[model samples]
Structure formats: structure tokens, C-alpha cells
Target: MATANTLERIFSVDYKSKIQPIVSLCIGGWGLENLSEPNEVTIDNSTGNIYVADSGNNCVKVFDCDGKIMFKFGDKEGKGKMYRPIGLAICRDRILISQSRNCILNYQVNGEFVSSIGKLGKGELEFINPLGLTFDESNGEVYICDYNDNRIQILSQELTYKAQFGQDNLHSPLDVKLTKEYIYILDGSNPCFHLYDYNLILHKSVISREHKLQVFIPFFFFIDNSNNILIITDYYSIAFLNSQLELIHRIPITQPNGVTVDNRGRVIVVCDGGEHHLNIF
Candidate 1:
């Protein structure tokens, strides 16, 4: 892995030259080809298929690498029904969706229903409003941001409860992402980012206001292969940070909600407002 200094030097080049629009997808609408208030996105690293949590439409949309519509799942009334799905994460062969209904729904990559867990509560294995989903590929564990619970819940790939942490420090955690060594969380209430270790030890907290950035509030974020942190802010911009949590660059965007990087190092952003389309760069 390259050091933070190296990554910073590499990203210091011209912004337009370093990143440019590569693809835009799903004009705003309720149709299958369009998206309404998409919340989160993730790439199937093995197949390069993109999975989007189409919240307003109450479904999940899958697209190929070229932004071609593959298929969509989640019905309003069915065995795999969904209600305002918000977060998404892909494990080995399953798709985990966190919805406002206070539960996490599990499905196969082919849209087959596997199982669902959680309900409205603060007890073990229960959630108030689940938001972000992230899978630890190394341990086959899934980390869920329990929104109202103010903590992160860990579950096995099989949907069984494992362990949880962060209630003492986090305030309305909106999203959680795990790299090989550290856990990154975006707190909507504190409007900051928290860094934790594998053992759930708090290392540091980054306040957006104190950073001297124009960010209003951070909604979601992604850590790329090189450990670069890409955060989508409510102020219509994305803030780039190095591994050491130093600001690298800030780019203009439109109502960005979720963000992720593809295997090819392309930055994919989900714009929930305005165009309600995805911008790939």
C-alpha cells in the first residue's frame, strides 16, 4: 500500500485531470430505467455488477458495468417486500439491505429471499432504524449502522448476532465502512467521522466544522482500494481525505448521498436530488 504522502502527492494534480465524468445513469423517475432517491450503492467486486438501494421506489436495482439495467428486486407486497431501503452491502453470495422498517433483509445475488432480522427496539439483535450495511470479507461478518440505537451491530453472514459497539460515543451513525485495519463511521448527529479499530476501540473523531471545509453534514462515505476516503456531504460536494484523515481535495457535486469506488478506481456517486442520477468518474 502507498503511504498517505504518496497518495496526497498523486492526488495533488489538476482536479479535472484526476477525475472526470465517465458515466451517468438512471434519469430521475419511478420507472425501472430511472431511479428515485437512491440511497446507497455497492459493487460486486467479483462480477463488477452495481447494486443500488432505490429507496423512494422501494426496491434494489442492479446494473452491469456499462450501466445497463440487469434487473431489480423488492416488492411492496411479497415474501421479499421492502420499505424505503437505504443501505446496501454485498457479501460472498448474498445482498444485505438496511431499511427504515428497522430490519435488515438478506437476499441472494439473484434476488432470491434468504432471511430478515431485527425490529423496532434497542435490545440485542433488534434495531430502531437500520441505515448502512458493510461486510467484513475477511471475517464473513456484517456491520450494520443502527441509526436510532446509536451503535453498530455485527452479524454473521448467516444473519445471526455476533457483537456490537459504539453506543458510548456515536450519535445517530448513518453509515459504517470497514477496511482491512480500521472501521470508519459517519455520524449524522455529531456531523463528524469516527475512526475505530478492529476491537471497537475509538482512535479519533473528525469534526467537519473544525476541518475548515464547506461541508454541512456528511451522509455517506467510501474507502477505496488505496484507502482514500471519499465522503458525500449534504452541501453538494465530496471531500477527499487521505488515510491519515487529512483533507486532500474537495469537488463539487449535486445532492450527493452515497459513494463508492469500482475495482478500476472509478469514483461512483449517487446523487439523490436534482438529477437523481449516478455520476461515475
Candidate 2:
């Protein structure tokens, strides 16, 4: 929780110098090679390729920097089958997808199935509804937001369960983002963001309404290289926060669910409602 003085310090700064991120490129539609109800988006910084968890299409779509479809994997009824992939992350040369079936599927960079990671349960090595995940390049570990379980599960680079935290405070944790010094979580039920140290110690909690922001039910978020936080909300806008967690700007879109920053520091958003396309800013 934040004190009144803390809130005052956060809101005292002028946020009038708004950032206007134009839609430089809009890719995909409702057909094949297009995106439908995409839930998550990640960038391979090394290759500058974009990977989208195309939930409705039951596959992961990869596109080049120019919005050209490179390849897609995960069929409806065959090998590497996935149902409603809602979470995606890039771990070095491997890709991890968390589907609605309550398990994380591992794949190679070239779209080859490696193995299944977890199952449907509440015990160790299990998950109820894994939503958003991120790979920590500093430590080679995977952090997954176990939605229904109300916890953040830690896994090794090999996808083996290591530890879990946040069950006592997080309510419907939707997304997890990692910075070198902290771990950030977006909780849908609480409709707030929680900041924690790498040791899993809760440092602060921020509610959008407390700061006079119009963010309603943040669905997912991404932390950029500069430590700026870009949050996708159900209210048809993306809220931007500075490294100090101050509300800085808000970019309006249709209905965005996922957001990420590219290697070039461009903001990429995935609009799932009424606009099934990727908007690059």
C-alpha cells in the first residue's frame, strides 16, 4: 500500500507533456496469416521478430519486423496442438505458450514442439490458469502469473518448477514483468499493480483510480528497456507510467489486451475487440 504522501509525490509532477504514439503500422485481419483475439505479444530482441498468441486461431503467429508473416505453429487437432493460447514469452532460443488447458507448452524458436511444462492442479509443477509470463535474462528463469491460483510461479530455464509467491495478496494476477531490480505484477481482480523486490518482498501497491487514471481492469502490461510501464486496460486505453510509477501518458486504442516494447523502443499493442490487428507505435 502507498501512503498519502507517496501518492502526492507521484501526482505532483506535471503530466501535460503527453506522449503521442501514432500507429505507424497496423498488421493482420480476420483471415489466415491474420490475428484473432490475440491475448499476448512478445518481441525477440535479437531477431526483431514479433510473436503473438493468437488465441482464437489456436496458434502462435510469428511476424517479421516489417509485419510479414514468417511462420505459425500449433494446429487445432494435430501434433503441437494448442487451445486458446493466452500467454506467451521468449526464453532465449525457446518459446513458451500458456494455453487455457492449464499447462505451458514449450517450443523451439523455429516452431518445433519441445515438451509440455505443467498440468492442471494447485500443487507444485501445476497451474490452474496461467496467463502472462516473462523470462528474466539476468537469471535465466521464467516467471508465470498463475491467474486462478493467485500466485507467481517461478521456473527454471528448463521449465521445471522452482518456487511460488503472492498467494496472500494477489487476486487474479494477470501479468508479470521483470526488471533488473524488481518484479511487477498486474492484478485484474484488484485492478492494481504490485511492485516487489527480486526477493519476493512487496514494496508498494498502486491503484490506478487512486492516481486519477482511467485505467479499468488492466489485462496485461510490459516493461520497456527504460523501465517505463505500458499497461493494456479494458477501458480502451494504454496507460504509461514512468520508472517511478507515476502516471505519465495514456494512448487510446479500441480494446487492447496485450502490449510490448520492441528493440527499437517502439510500443506494440494487440487489439482484440473490434480490431484484430497489431498496432505499432
Candidate 3:
């Protein structure tokens, strides 16, 4: 669209056949070089579009797989409209978002406003600090991690409460990932990932002494088509682990946090690669 300052772009020449191998995600792209600080990131496999929570900028930015900026939403300081932007998720088509002050917002695939289904409350159904949101595609329910309230709330596709998962013992259930059978939680405070059945029963927990931040903000992790957990380290790298809790591989990335790998094994990570550069790997 408009000509703007473009930052660093180092796409491995070999990273072209299908989803080329990611040698290492060290530096971030220039697309985010000038972008405000970012939080979490997700990719729309159907459209090959990458979505980023530009938290510091108080908006969401979209990019293509080649790392080109498509567009961005939100305003500086997030005062006029967007405020304290936090976590994000995408369903079959729409995008779900959580902003500070207990605001839950949604947008359609075309970026049209859909509905905001949550608010601040002390009840079991409402949200205090809604940290993460993801749709359980296999079950037609959206699982939400309510940070301040310490609970995971599940809702139907239409935004009706179907079930709630979690307990006070769950420090900060940051993100919810669903496999064919159980719900995966990136327990932020414990800095570990825990699993539970769809019925809301804890199954297993894989502790990570990997890093302090990993211990805190496994902010976003997703399972691949092969069922391996691609965990975004609190620092620079991603660890691929099987269901057995053994580390299969680790790829060094930069300021890595919000991360997701799609059905095709395409990985997108959100990072302020350098001091203020937003890079997607």
C-alpha cells in the first residue's frame, strides 16, 4: 500500500521448497523493525496470513509468509480505541482477542467486528484478565484462560458457556491448546505445560527447567499435525517435544514468544528480535 521504512529481511534462500527449513530465527524482520512492541502471534493456515498482537502499538498486524507487512490495526498508546492488547486466537474463520481492563473482542475473517462476549466479573462465567483464547476445532468449543480468575472457560461456537476448566492451584493458565483428546495448558506462573482431558481433569504435566521465562510465559505454544508440541521459549528458541515429554529438537529463535505451527508445518513466531524490531519466524 503505502511506502514505509523496511527493516532487515533474511529469508534463507533454501527456505523455499514448501516450508523451507528454519535454520535459526536469530534476527527479526524489518516489517516489525518499526512496529511497536508485540505480544503473541498466530498464523491463518487457510490464508497463509500471520497475525500479531502489537501490544505496545495497541493493535494487530498482519503479514504474509514471506514476512511482508500486509496491514495493521490499533492506535498508539491504545487509548482512543484499543487498550492493553494481550492474547489472540483464531477459530474456523474469526479471530478472538483479549485486551486489558477485561475487554473481550472478536473479528470475522474479513476483519469485521463480530461480538465481544466477555467482561470483568467475579462470577464463574465471566473473565477478569482473559489471557489466552483458542478454538477446539474437533469439539466446536473455544477454550479461554482467565488469568486473574485462575480458570479455563470453554464455550460453544456461538459464545455460550459449555464448560469451565481449571482451579485456584493453576497459577496462570496462559494458553489453551486442544489435541484430538485433551486440552493442553501453558501454565505461565509455574512455567510449565499441563494437560487435561476435555472433561477438565488434569492428565499430565511436563516440567521445563529450560528457562525462567519459559517457566513464566509459555505465552503461546501449538501442536503440529504430527502432534509434537512446538513450545515458544521465553527466550530465543523453540523446543519440539513429543507427547512423551522428551525434547525432540530445539531451534534457536529470537525473543521468541507467541508461536504456532500450522497443518503444513509452517511456523510463525512473534518477537522483538532486536531492541525494537518485530520479527516473524
lDDT of each: 0.78, 0.76, 0.63
Candidate 2 per-residue C-alpha lDDT over 1-281 given as tens digits, one digit per residue, 9 for 90 to 100: 11100111121322233355445344446565788888888887669898889888888999887677889988556446899999888866888899999998889878889788888999987999999988876566888999999999999866788999999889999988776567888888858888898778998988866765546767888765344444455557888777766766877677788777665556677887665867777
Q: Is candidate 1 or candidate 2 better by TM-score?
A: 1
Q: What is the lDDT of residue 273 in candidate 1?
A: 69
Q: lDDT tens digits, residues 1-281, model 3? A: 11111111322211123222442333233344335556777777678777777777667778777667677665343222566577877766888788886866777655566666766885755888887777766545678888888888877877887777677457877777766666777877767777787567888776777633233335667665344344555565666665565665666655666776544455566666665333433
What is the clash count of model 2? 0
Q: Arrange candidates by TM-score, descending.
A: 1, 2, 3
Best by TM-score: 1
Superpose all Cα atoms of candidate 1 onto the true structure and report the RMSD in Å to 1 decimal: 3.9
Q: Tell me the spans in candidate 3 whose CA falls farther than 4 Å from its real position.
A: 1-33, 74-80, 210-217, 273-281
In candidate 2, how many Å is residue 192 off? 1.0
- C-alpha root-mean-square deviation, each candidate: 3.9, 5.9, 7.8
TM-score of each: 0.90, 0.87, 0.79
Worst 10 residues of 1 by lDDT: 1-10
Q: Give one digit per residue, the lDDT tens place, for model 1 in 71-180.
A: 99996675478998999988778888998888888899888887778888998889988998788776678889998989999887577989999999999998888766
